[model samples]
Target: MPIPSTLIGIPASPGRAGGRVVRVAEPPGEPATGPAPADPAGEAARIEPAVELVSTRLTARAATVSGDAREVLEATVTMVGDPALLQNAQELVTERGRPAARAVWEAANGFAATLSSMGGYMAERARDISDVRDRIVAELLGLPAPGVADLDAPAVLVATDLAPADTAGLKPGVALALVTEQGGPTSHTAILARSLGIPAVVGCAGASTLTDGSAVIVDGATGEVGEVATLDEAVEAAAAAAVVTDWDGVGRTADGHVVPLLANVGDGPGAAKGAADGAEGVGLFRTELAFLSAAEEPSESRQREAYVAVLSAFAGKPVTARTLDAGADKPLPFLSLDGEPNPALGVRGLRIARDGSGGDGAGVLDRQLAGLAAAAKETGAELKVMAPMVATAEEARWFVERCRTHGIGRAGVMIEVPAAVLTADEIMREVDFVSVGTNDLAQYLFAADRQSGPLAALNDPWQPALLRLIGMLGEASERTGCPVGVCGEAAADPALASVLVGLGVASLSTGPGARAAVGAAIGGLTLAQCRERAAVARAAADPIDARRAVAALDG
Candidate 1:
């Protein structure tokens, strides 16, 4: 008997969905044996043509990709064209007398182990190279391209995994839902689906076991994927329901009051869209996007173009652009970063900015500050530059001074570390404003990984301890007469928006689609009511009680 199944995973996209499964399998395996090479040197000579062919093909397709994808491919090209790898392979062939291809394979594996050990951005680059090498080897042995489902029609897509590049061309309207056997909530597929508001489920075991044309129903909100027939009745029952209202502006309460709605954007194009969608301004424009997608440090002109686009998109509205916050987790290949036992706590954010260690080299902060200042001067845009992971007043002052020296008048510090919040007044004295990066702040506060499944219980933003910390920051901001805002996922949550407003957040920034809903929720209450609700929430014993308190306030 075939039991109806309802697999659950992370929701990457959002929408109602009912469709058939389209399974895409992994690439086929390579042959076990091949024609023997004549000699060591001869073997090396024999493989030269194949290496050149792979190199040429990669170079030819280089222009097709842009932004982060382009950077990944470029690094791939570099690894394939690495003279050291080829040299090592040739040496191995001449000394050990191995087949040329086999020698290259062994050499590549050794290089890969070194890369894995190095970690950081180099490790990510190495993985890309390894992937390409595998594909090239397969091609050389006459194997077909990796299995790819023809997404010719709209269906609930199921696969073992998906690459970021594979998701770039996904047809938003047609692709109603997706399920993958493996992927974290923060992976590229999940991020893209969420951005597109498409329903998705990731990390579902046996997700690929579902055959093609097998009917399924995906519930993005709950991360549920079930057989279609099992859900068809429910789908039919809800088919006649009223159209969903647009919830895209400033959140409001029962009674209307104006609340700032903002967007956390990564690039110029995204900023433009967010602004068009009625984002009051950019809450967090991650400058790292400019750096990540480049072979070298982006030229001042290129940086200017990105900055200007974002600033112009918001027009006279304020745009808070955080400087390069790269670290071990999101490293740049060109930057020489040593592997850290605990990277999150190691040299990252302001630590890296101040120390110039971990491959930033001397004058790294100066160049970043100067570029941002120049971009501001050229665009004449209302831009505020902030430093991430600021922990102390001294660090805040150091960053502010650097920005001031570069002619950037407005400087802010991200309140991600506990020390920053604890010393908010001192830090405020050295900067223009403070924006709570609640996600990391909460993670650090609770000693939990926001991305870890086992730590989910500790990751709730509404936890009383986290709320108290936020309240402390709010009180400090009030005492110092400094504007305080929140630019994190918590800022957009409807359930938490009122408490945040009550906590005296001057602005609440989230994704573009969530702006209206948050704005509407905020509009329903006055500052005094929000404060009262926040007090009730703070005084509550647990998240459950706190949520009830928030709900009462909303009611």
Candidate 2:
């Protein structure tokens, strides 16, 4: 037999493993034509039960996990139960005389298309809609729902890409690692894999062509996959990776330059995990947790309790909390825009309040800041608050004023918009600090959809243009004396972590599972070496050459 050529991909979660491949089967295709129901109402009624079953199943799955995984599953459950989806399905069944399964398929595709057209985070939601649509349609057809089949033994799970529910349900003991032909660093597959401490390589060129049960090696750090001589050898490699190592509660390069290693957390449990994993503090406390399940704005006290849970966990360590980042992909029932042609570019993040929509969305930010202030007082924690999607210096000043009104001493803005990077010096002068959200930044910079597999290269952190933007922010931070941090999927990559530090980022914030590896990667090198590599990476013409040039620097 011929040896399989090594496949290159993006390193999502850092670790190394090897195993026999267990390919996840594709979802059920378009359902066959079925006999029309006797009545349109009856056909439409069938949609509810199917949706309920899928929702119940998803809810159960969510119960077994917490933090980001739980949030992803719960969001999917909400998608399953969306009334708009029901109405769309009903209209198709009643007006078009379609069967329940076909109605659901058509309705879901239409909605997914709308989301895809919006790009950025919205495109990712489109994939989730398709996953839920498949499960619900399968229920109506009396067929088993699509997902990773239950693993009877330890193996590498290979797929085109995993859905949120599919990735959330994976167990580390049985699912050795994940390798997907499609998906980018900021994809749900990458985020969930890091949370689970599973090695993952996404966007592998030839991953889907490997046969089921073939022995292969998956190096998540290097994004390499190739055939191994035997399954025994693969098992040995995986077993070797199982040995545990602990992280000392300090983050610095070999030459003694301090780089704060913080954690991106969603809730109390996630905060605790991050702290336990030696996170200096919470770099990004995603405030969306309080909003995701709420039908309306949560009370100040309710929001305070949730904030207190995380702030108290970190204690004296600084916890940077971001206000509600809803709309676009994460539309809230109470705080959603009406019929925006492109919600991704519309009233999302800071604009949700600043856009002057009929609702007092600005009040939403005010109340949130008030709740965070209350929580900070109650917990006696070092609370640093920030707003997302601030593109201009004026917007940065507006957010800072809101933070000041709430008596929050520290305030910042997330550098997700390209304009934020371009005018970073001006914006930084208006705030205390800034953290770059490389995921959204990459999408907007390249004008490529973040969730599109084929466009993953453009969204990749290795892109010179993306690094140049971060460099611009770093330069601004230097001039303004405003600390810069990265709390994005890019920070989770061990190699990129080094480059980001070289680019003058003050802190690197990532998933708890990634801290040790990122710390170790930086621990071996002096800041000078990191800076040299960053310069080398920036000089490369493309993502591929950038990665290769950086790798060659070790020699």
Error of 2 at 22 (Å): 0.9
Each model's TM-score, in the order given? 0.74, 0.92
Please report, in order, the local distance difference test score of every candidate based on alpha carbons: 0.69, 0.86
Those runs of model 1 whose alpha carbons end farther than 4 Å from true positions after fitting are 1-5, 27-144, 205-211, 230-254, 289-306, 327-343, 356-362, 422-429, 438-555
Decoy 1 TM-score against native: 0.74
The lDDT, on a scale of 0 to 1, for candidate 1 is 0.69
Task: Please write out the lDDT profile of model 2 over residues 1-555, one tens digit for every residue.
Answer: 111437988878877788899999777889765677779888889999889999999999999987788878988998999999999998889988899999999999999998888765667789899999999988998887787988889989999878989999888868888999989877899989987889998999888788898998788776778778899887676566553544466788989999999999889888888888789998999998799778888999999999998999988889999988887567788875776777777778888888867277988889899999999998888999999988999999999998998899999999998988888889988999999888889989988778778887788888999999898888888889999999988898778889999999999999877788788888878999999988988888987788778878866
| lDDT string, candidate 1, 1-555, tens digits | 111346755544444477667775464443333344566566677556767776676665556644333444455677777889888878877777766556666777788777655443344444455555555565555565443445787766787776444443355557667788766454456655655556677777768667888777776544567775544543453243212545545445545545677888877767777877888888898888788757687767677777787777776778899988877666677567676776777777767766656565336667777777776776666779899988999988888888888888889989998888888889988889999987688778888655544454465566789899899888888888888889976675554788888877888887754565466556655778888988998988976567667656545
TM-score of 2: 0.92
Candidate number achieving the greatest TM-score relative to the actual structure: 2
Q: Candidate 2, clashing residue pairs?
A: none
Clashes of 1: 25
